[model samples]
Target chain A: MAEATTRERILGAADRLFGSHGFRGTSLRALTREAGVNLAAVHYHFGSKHELLVATLSRHIDAINAARIAQLDALEAAHPNGDIPPLDLLNALVRPAFAFRHASPENAEVVQRLSALLHSEPLEIVHPLMEGLFSRVMQRFAAALERALPDLEPEEVYLRIQITIGAMVSALAGRHPPDLADAPGLDEEERIDHLVHFLAAGFSAKPLNGADS
Target chain B: MAEATTRERILGAADRLFGSHGFRGTSLRALTREAGVNLAAVHYHFGSKHELLVATLSRHIDAINAARIAQLDALEAAHPNGDIPPLDLLNALVRPAFAFRHASPENAEVVQRLSALLHSEPLEIVHPLMEGLFSRVMQRFAAALERALPDLEPEEVYLRIQITIGAMVSALAGRHPPDLADAPGLDEEERIDHLVHFLAAGFSAKPLNGADS
Candidate 1:
């Protein structure tokens, strides 16, 4: 109900501009104008465009990861022996992301666009950012997934997790194939349900054989 | 090998520049410099930067789709009754894209980078482009997938196909979770195998129940 602070305003502006124009294409002047803040204010707050991007992304990613970890903690505590179902583990990893939709609709759109943009950025920018921000949580989930799918090799577990992330990112970006006349307009809950179902099935698939027929 | 024509050289440059810098970020002057050609040559060959991008992407996508359709035709013909195994239909959908890897590793990298960049481009750019270039092939595969999975609803098939595409595009871009100390470095064939196996399982997953516990 209260007005957003200078930093929050700047981050929100950055999300919209960077989401639309990309990190490289977006200019500081434009960013400042969008935020209705001056260059001096931006410098005092975020120091550089790069740092601003980091902050803007961190605001969302940190919250999502925290929610993921909290869910994982509760799920693990309930099991005690770490025998969580793959479906529940996957839901923990995925639901937090889809939960972003429950935020104001405009905010959800900005975050999803920004997330998709991050994936398409050059490897130099994205790789280090992901490694720095996501390594801990990603590794935690990988270990949990490995525990849940004991029959699968660790490498296989990691590969499926990567593919699952891809599906999640794609769905978040709403990157469906072009132009289906009767494409079902699924609600947020249905989207999450379908994604989790697909991923859980993938994670449970039998290990590949060279002569798989 | 024969020398590449002036147009070929310009198309090649467009792919690399567009792939790395993005469509909006890459300038005509920069593209000319990269191709070792003058601005006139690019204009003469492709009319505008937009058309140049279309030509560059079309060179690869057209071939990949042709391969996909060819494989699909063979699979369907062999099945005769439209009872083709989902895995084979999936293979038809996926294998052609991965085959790009065999066309010299450098060219393969360029195509993959460009494809990833395309996904990140603004919807106005990507949407029309995809519809114009890919709609037919996408619909064809969707119908085949629907036939292959009789138990699933058409919307469910489309959603899974979209998710499969997300997974495939992510894999093509070589997007992975960062910092797995011994993350298995899957070679090309192995990567395709793992992907097909995962997708087949996902496509064949039982339809979701509301109270899936």
Candidate 2:
């Protein structure tokens, strides 16, 4: 129990520091200081700074991905004939992340910071970290979406999925320009509904005439 | 004439280096070297790195923003009764950036890189640079969208516009996973049409039932 507590402490510290300072900006020394543990504890729990980052991110992302997959599974089972609506699939794709954020207010900030860092960080850093994180989940959702939208080509489904991910990421990051004085302050549920409605409509849009180049 | 050439060269170099190396990663020395100009030349022209970035971004963005506003003006004039369709408004909001990209292949990479940088960079760096850049254009589009879609509230229009911008930025970045081997390679024109169609449908989507929370 004591050993487990130390590991949790290190991870907790890693989460806060990494979110605030970014991967390259945060030092192990600062991490140890924040966790109130020495270098040995960190080394024992996580092998390196890179490993620590993976661990920190996985703590939340793993849960979110699992929740997404489970939602998809339930949706698929509910429609064994593979006749799920696009909106349901979109909700499966989007709502878990929002739920994760709303589960704790601090999670919102940490997730946003980490996401911003991933997007802004160099390719070398972001590529490896993000490689497997979303691929499996994305592939699953892409297949489901393609099935749901029969008229749309598979490639089109994938393209829209990528664009949807961008929208979700941007919304999650919540980094609106301060000058948009009256930016709506919707609670989590409203934001999720708006996103789902917007994306569902986008996904359902017909292929443009002569859109092929 | 010579001074104008020097200024253009520096801006060009800044675009490339900043796109590839990011704001913090690119050094003044590297920029000057790439520009084939001396330190004194950069100092005399832009005065500081921050200003240099603003100037570099503005070179292309100013044109794009102006083009967007001009397109909006034309659309508004065409529909003197304020009955412009949502699709036309979306085309106005999105096409200029695509036009800017299609004008030159190099502009695509620079714009994508700078956009990625702006989204990922720390708030302190991103905030002031982005403050006035998109405010007017966003507000203009938001108001037009509100007018076009009178059924939706103003806040909803603003929210969808922000989400649309997210999709646009993500598409422009073109940083898909290398593993997604079959990712469709759409040309600039086709991509623009598809995006405009998607966003038009999204903007036109009715407010969700009981979405207000």
Give model 1's docking category: medium
**Total backbone clashes of model 2?**
0
Candidate RMSDs in Å, in order, are 3.4, 3.5
The TM-score leader among the candidates is 1
User: Model 2 over residues A108-189: C-alpha lDDT tens digits?
Assistant: 5566655555555567777766767878888888888888888887667777887788788778877453345566566667
Alpha-carbon runs more than 4 Å astray in model 2:
A1-10, A21-29, A36-55, A121-129, A175-179, A209-213, B1-9, B37-51, B119-125, B175-181, B209-213
**Which predicted model would earn the best DockQ?**
1
Q: What's model 2's overall lDDT?
A: 0.77
Taking the tens digit of each residue's C-alpha lDDT, what string does model 2 give over B1-213?
A: 335588888888887787777776788999989888897788898888868887877788889999999999999999888878988888887788878887866656566665555544566777777777888887787778888888887667778887888788777766443234466566566767788888888888878758344
Off by over 4 Å in 1: A1-6, A19-27, A40-47, A209-213, B1-5, B16-27, B40-47, B114-116, B209-213
